[model samples]
Target: MITLFGVGCLVFLVVCALVVARTRDLLAATVVFAAYSLVMALVWQQLQSPDVAITEAALGAGITSLLFLLAIGRTRRTEDEEG
Candidate 1:
């Protein structure tokens, strides 16, 4: 029952995962992780779980990204003052 689009999304998910893992910059990794979460939300929608998709989109992509950005901003300022 797997379609081509599903396969493509899966491949993209793997690539995003690798990029997030290899990236050393926290901000860059957070952006990529957000993208990965959005794609995962799409995958969940494709799998017919609209509730999970909505949750992932809201919590994983939206709130988590915002929280990570806030944390990065605070830590960067602290590091700058110390260095």
Candidate 2:
């Protein structure tokens, strides 16, 4: 049986995915993506995979987010047509 908490986490994950896809702002999208990664880490933890959870938290949420933020800082925040 699926637990209520699991369902809630799944729902939140989907919502975060949609928000990340729809948002044009790179910074906002990156923030949401980080949140999604953190939740994914939590899910991995609940699945009895502490190794995967720690790796995901460190790499997915931490290193990846930092790289994205650094890239965004050096580029345009939004994609706009340039003539």
Candidate 3:
């Protein structure tokens, strides 16, 4: 029962996942990962799971991305101090 829009979202999600995995930059990877999460949330919504979609949007795309960014920043600072 998948529509064209749903298929498109699936494709986009896969592409984003691949990009996140292949990217060398941590920040870029994190951003791509967040995008993937957002797409996933959309898919969940289309599937009629509003609660799961909201949770994914809030945690996966929001707090998780913020945490990754902060961690990356801290790691960069540590590397700078060591080198």
- Winner on TM-score (2 vs 3): 2
**Stretches > 4 Å off in candidate 3:** 77-83
TM-score of 2: 0.90
Per-prediction TM-score to the true structure, in the order listed: 0.89, 0.90, 0.89
For model 2, the superposed segments whose C-alpha errors exceed 4 Å read 81-83
The CA lDDT at 18 in model 2 is: 100
lDDT, model 3: 0.89
Off by over 4 Å in 1: 77-83
lDDT of 2 by residue, 1-83 (tens): 56788788889999999999888888999999999999998888777899999999999999999999999999989966552
Per-residue lDDT of model 3, residues 3-75, tens digit only: 9999999999989989886667778888889999999999999999999999999999999999999999878
**Which 10 consecutive positions of candidate 2 have the poorest summed lDDT?**
74-83
lDDT of candidates 1 onward, in order:
0.91, 0.89, 0.89
Q: Which ten residues in a row have the lowest lDDT in candidate 1?
A: 74-83
| Cand. 1 Cα-lDDT | 0.91
**Two-way lDDT contest, 1 vs 2, winner:** 1
